[model samples]
Target: MSEVREYIAHARSVVIKIGSSALTDLADGLDKARLDRLADAIEARMRAGSDVIVVSSGAIGAGIAPLGLKKRPTDLATKQAAASVGQLALAHAWGTSFARYDRTVGQVLLTADDISNRAHHANAQRTLDRLRSLGAVAVVNENDTVATNEIRFGDNDRLAALVAHLAGADALVLLSDVDGLYDGDPRKVSETGERARFIPEVSGPEDLDGVIAGSGGALGTGGMASKLAAARLSADAGVPVLLASAEQAGQALADASVGTVFAARPERLSARKFWVRHAADARGQIVLDDGAVAAVSRRRRSLLAAGVVGVEGRFSDGDVVELVDTTGRIHARGVVAFDSDDISSMMGAHSEELPADLARPVIHADDLVPL
Candidate 1:
């Protein structure tokens, strides 16, 4: 059907995430040849007028053996240190591989903090967009060295989804060790068994429940479940996802039905709503007056100084917050213009009665990514 080709033929921008198992050797170091093949495939796609951003996972895995460790380190500090060393190695490998096609490569390392904060998210997107515009491939990875437990991407699968949303990517390809999602753990079942059937549609989380093929292998951080979750997120953003083996990278890009393709939702969320509902985590809440609620919920206008009634929790400017009406039901999620304390003071004050300096928006419509 045209629906399948529709995504592939029109995917001007895409996010391709390769797992550690695809990029490195569990026993030794980076797999340069496989890396080269992947880069070549990306180059091929670029030649076809697609802007590709690569989210890779291999830093800690590549650093494992060289640091005299037997396997992935358990201690956070050691893992961070190893990632610092391995990141250089990983970047260099990608750079060298990409250069073979006479193409330039740019390295981008991001943490969860980058997307959680509005400013950092904007800057990160701008940088990646600029790099792609300059005819360079932007190779991204998690900032494992500086990322702590609370701020780390946790796994690159989720990072790829966030990047897809940030880059406005049309599709997200998650390449892993397995071919695709199966009915059960394919590794435990015979190849000719019922589990070999590829799943074509996953309507909801229930469709994926107990459908894991395998957990994360020794070298990778993500398992089959994480990839499925990433697919769901991307699909919800109106961007379909492809879960396939790294070996089928080229075919997947060509839109071949060689793997599982998670269908996108028929309806797409508005950009701001998508950002607020999916990308940014809510930090606080702002209760609005009846008129203000009507303006935002129905008219979709910016929140002004007049409508605020109450504030809950501490939040900074540009942080996403829940917008609740008088009855205590959340009407939307938006960014707050003023901090919690400032909003508390601005509450119930009309624009004309407020001090000249305090008359600005309590929550700017543009700043608010309404959910």
Candidate 2:
């Protein structure tokens, strides 16, 4: 409990995420009392001199009952329609509740593409920073109405992590229906079930080996898997995360370990590197020779053509590609300097042998990001 409290006490800026299950009822349009409870808790935090940003997930759920739908919509069109209608109501309810504390709320809707694009990412960071600086709590959500399959955030859990990274938040709190990550499903009630445990440290991916995956409530898309993924991502960026039940939200923020606490690391990656390493999809692989590997891994230099061994997949220049070693393990990712066709021709060639106009390294070391 002190561990959880110590974590929250140290966080100067926080990103608090409330899932649909926390803010809505099965048949109600929106749970106003629950929203007020959450708002009041956040207001207390703000009064304590901490900056808070709320990444809320309930637009579609809020619209479901109001639109006379029995359950969450199945198709994307209806989901988008629901989001369009529900977002206004969601913002209104939040605003009304926040007013009790004399706190202003600002809305920020983002799509996955917005963060993936460098320019848009900068714009988002600037906007959120300004809003927080002005003493307003930024209520963020995915722009579900305008997002397509290609542009969707998929889950708000991931969005919260991304927002924490974007906002340079001190910590991230993910409020869900469940208490926290369990060794196995607590519902199993087995003789050896570790129903509740605090994850104080995450050394690597193996730390998440025995975690369980489960679905969300009828109105949400993010489940335990997405929340864990968010934990890993945000933790990697040096932002600690608290995963707790919505029922215990106030306690969760009060230093109570109501859920699993993922400790943040000290060597956090830069925002660009974090987004590049985790968020971007690699379009191809560039296998490097030993010399290039040493240059990159040891000297932190851009990949030179003399170190190229092979190229895989169809990729255009400026697209993200994986840098692999002889063992076929990805060591880094970066924007490729040449198209796949050009790289194929340039492989195994000396710098002078390449055309003068194409003399640059295959993937400059400065642009490369180690995985």
Candidate 3:
């Protein structure tokens, strides 16, 4: 059940993310041959009755030569300008490539707000669902054209994982230039002439101990670190993720031994809870004492004000806030029961000693999502 082949065989829906270096060239822009091959792999999966969505990167790279830039733009406005020009080329390249297999592709651009906002997340989910039902493949990408530095998803790796959550994908395949996760630097041969050991399976987040992070490719923004982060996010939500090379996409989808696979978590989260865990932008933080941490993490109890030691940031009642430990590790997120100022005065008081209206748990378990 932990094997990638087994998972792919039963995966009815998938999100396939292609990294930039796999497709773009600074001198020539989008690589048509490579894109067509990717489309073929996607088409094969679609033909197998699996709904497929592509979270693509390469917009910035594609703009390099066409706009006569020697390298990637560094400034914000220039970067957005590049993305504005490149998005059209990226979308057309995908559309034309997929057309060879008679597949219809629809572009769906998104920003962080699209998922972080509850109402918007539902709208995005429904749009993807409709596209799948109509046999149209979704070509998803970050809307870099208008995204600001503060609001953008820095790389497509995390974006792909979020898209998997939004689409309820059973499997996520992240394609890069590297073969897969390795115990050491795959490029550096050992003293015994052995290459880095390729890790075929990671059962949980803790298993990622010895894996080294690689730098982004010349035309890409993500490295091994980002891909692993993406895998963890999707796996946490019960969707297995495959980390493989772009060359092995078809084989990977067919369940061949081609990449490292992250096992899906045993706990499947509800859609809203998943959103709260990953998408919600916390307006504030509530620092919990050891006793409160034990009560919430172990006892699964609501957060009473008696355990609150500190509060940071100004936020209103009902806003989402992070629940952190004394060491600042975020353990949960929940809708607060009272304003930050009100909660500050109520800290350390016994529940029964507080005013009747404030005698409740500061955050109810029903509204809390563990991180």
Candidate 4:
């Protein structure tokens, strides 16, 4: 507990993710009072000399009442329409709330492409850095208005985790409906007649075994499973995470003992490696022979064409692909150096035996991230 408090005290920057269940309702839309309270809490953190970024989820839910929809739309197109309308209202509400304290808020909407593509990812990092430097709280959300199913983040919880890495945050606070993680579903009593127990900390993946993740609320897409996934993602990147109820936003931000804290891993992956391992969408798969698997996964060597067994899916040079063993287990993710067709033709041939243009590594070690 002392260590957790120390970690929170030393965190210079943090990302706060507020879910839809905490921000809106199916019929009432955005809750002005709740937004104000949250804004006030964020402002307090800023006044305390810590940089803060908010990854908010409520665009579609906030649009429900305005669009006369009785519930969340199941179709992609209608959901996108609602997001477009609600995005404006959501941003305005945030802007208006922060205005009370004379704090400026900047809205940043992102699609999956924005975070996965190298160039776009760099651009986003620059924008976020500049916003922080200028003392503005960046309000980020998934760009559901224009995102297709293929490029959507699916939920803001995942987006927040990715953003924590992108923004180089020291901590991430996930504000949801539940107070914290529990050993069992908090809504039900166990056969032993005992209620679920609140977990103060999660040290590793093993802590989650046997834990039941309850379903999400009517207005939110993410349940406990998504929150845990997000926490692990950020924790792996060396950012600690706190999961708490929205009602306790102030305590959570203050690093009080009010939520579950996920410990950060000691070894942090490089930004590029982390991106490849978690963010880049695999466009294809390169199946390797046994020898190739050992070399790439164990020795961390560049993938050579001599041990290539097969190629699955069509992908261009420089696209992200999965490096898998012949048995279909993925060993790594890498940026391939050749087109799928070219790789197909070069497989099983040594580099020295190939033409000068095709003699290089199929995937450079620097571009590979072992899973």
Candidate 2 lDDT, 28-93, residue by residue in tens: 889999999888878877887889999999999998888899989989999999999899999999
Q: What digit string (tens of lDDT, one per residue) describes model 1 on residues 248-313?
A: 988877764677778788876666667787777779889998899988888878898678888889
Model 3 sits at a Cα RMSD from the real structure of: 1.7
Query: Which stretches in model 2 have alpha-carbon errors above 4 Å?
Result: 1-5, 190-206, 281-284, 287-301, 306-316, 324-331
Regions of candidate 1 where Cα sits further than 4 Å from its true position: 189-197, 203-215, 285-312, 316-318, 322-332, 336-371
- lDDT string for model 3 (1-371, tens) is 45655876569999999999888888888898998888888888788888999999999888887999988888888888888888999999998888887778899999988988889899999999999998888999999888888887768999999999899888899998988999788889989998888888899656878677776777888899889888898888888888999988788877646788888888778887887788877899999999998887777789999999999999998789999999999888988989999999999999889999999999999888876
Q: Name the runs in model 4 displaced over 4 angstroms.
A: none
- Model 4, 1-371: lDDT tens digits are 65755686558999999999888988799999999999988888888889999999999998998999999998999999999999999999999999998889999999999999999999999999999999888999999899988898878889999999999998888998999999878889989999998888888888888788766678888999899888999998988888999999888777556888898898877898889998989999999999999999999999999999999999999899999987899999999999999999999999899999999999999999888
Q: How well does model 3 score by local distance difference test?
A: 0.87
TM-score of each: 0.80, 0.89, 0.95, 0.96
Q: Is candidate 2 or candidate 3 better by lDDT?
A: 3
How does candidate 4 fare on TM-score? 0.96
The lDDT of each candidate is: 0.83, 0.85, 0.87, 0.91
- What is the Cα-based lDDT of residue 329 in candidate 3? 96
In terms of lDDT, model 2 sits at: 0.85
